[model samples]
Target: MTAALVEEAVKKAAVAWINVGAGPARALWCLPVDGTLIVVSGPGEQTAPELPEATRATVRLRGDTGGLIVICETAVARIAPGSEDWAALAPQLAAKRLNASGTADDLVARWENDGCAIVRLTPATDQPAAAPALPDDAQAAPPRETPARVPVRRPFRLHRVRRR
Candidate 1:
């Protein structure tokens, strides 16, 4: 896919997933790199294990026919067709790998023979601009005053006492 197309797809696909391995399940940002996807497994406060550049992968799709086979690297991975393991791993791989740096044929070959897949690299999505602040000179509206409460008193009543 073209760089722009890849970038758009990555942007659309970029999402946060829970790292279940860690207790309490932490959130991580899945960023798309040039030829791989980077998963910020945890916020800066928490430290995560340093993963290797390559490992076995399984790709699975939601409500799909079959899974694909793949191999995952630091920020990239390769996918092969007709691999159930690859399908099971696709979501995680896609979430982690965004950039398409290598050629499609190379990626396919890597998967078909070596049990790996090629992921394209895409540009990071731009954040939305902040809203403009109101001018200091803008007149402040006066606060509305609440009505004061009044107390009600009942008049004293006198009754004639009957002698027993």
Candidate 2:
């Protein structure tokens, strides 16, 4: 039942914010397939997650009432490109991509042509639902420093020309 709930929420939610290892949360386009959540990450894809070949992740979802729902203890892995599992999950993943440039087939081809990593996040074992906790340092990074003085440009005026 817990697994089903996790899968359902993942598929229904527009974005799944997952945290792998000690990294911060990342909102990604996720698809729940074969009892697991799959996410594509690359330069041009949804988000470039820091997940390696294998790791654990925590997925954050939403309930019907726009409340927080957390699916914890997820095992993460990067699927091999062009492998059987990757091919099977490609169409489903591509379909969920909002405003994808081309057809499902084309998207898969592009993912392959590019060095995109198709990451899979599945339940590590039998785990119950729980509320997610805020990170210790929840504040965003500081903005870049800029020069104190600023330059101002004068506005230009348009001149009317006489008709010939």
Candidate 3:
């Protein structure tokens, strides 16, 4: 019953916050395939440091209302490019990627060329994946430091001169 809930929660959410090892939880777009979640990380992709090397990770999914839904421990497996699994799954992942620059094939090629890590996250059967209850306090944290910044607005011409 709990496993079903985990699967249902995962199926509904497009993104999940994954914490690999002792690192901070990072939001990653996920693709559900064959009862597992597929996540890609590397250069020009989402940042998930140590995910490919880590054997285990914690996956947190949010509800439709944007609230916490379920938290699960997942077994991580890195799928090598050019493998049978990669061949089948990469196209699916590329199709699901929103705002992707190129065709699915092109994106897959780029992923391959850039040496991206395609990881499969399987929910662990032994560990409890679901949270007992929703917490009363708001789960908010200070924003992480980044070099990227918002750009200034361009000048607007409010009034137009009337032609004689």
* Candidate 1 ranges with C-alpha deviation above 4 Å: 1-11, 16-27, 41-54, 57-164
Q: Write the per-residue lDDT of candidate 3 for residues 1-164, one digit (tens) a residue.
A: 67787878777768998998767889999998877899999999999878999899988888778878777899999999999999999999999999999899999999999989999999886644455665556656677787886668978879986889
lDDT of 3 at 39: 97
Ranking by lDDT: 3, 2, 1
Provide the overall lDDT of each model, using Cα atoms, as 2-decimal numbers: 0.33, 0.74, 0.86
Better of 1 and 3 by TM-score: 3
TM-score of each: 0.22, 0.71, 0.84
Clashing pairs in 3: none
Q: Residue 140's C-alpha lDDT in candidate 1?
A: 30
lDDT for each residue of candidate 2 in 122-164, tens digit (9 for 90 to 100) = 7665774654443444335454345865668877659865789
lDDT at residue 141 of model 1 (Cα atoms):
43
Over 4 Å off in model 2, which ranges? 1-8, 126-164
In the range 1-164, model 1's lDDT, one tens digit per residue, is: 23343344344434422222222322333544443444422222123232223342111111122211111112223334566644444444434434644654444344455433333222222321111221234333454343664556876659865789
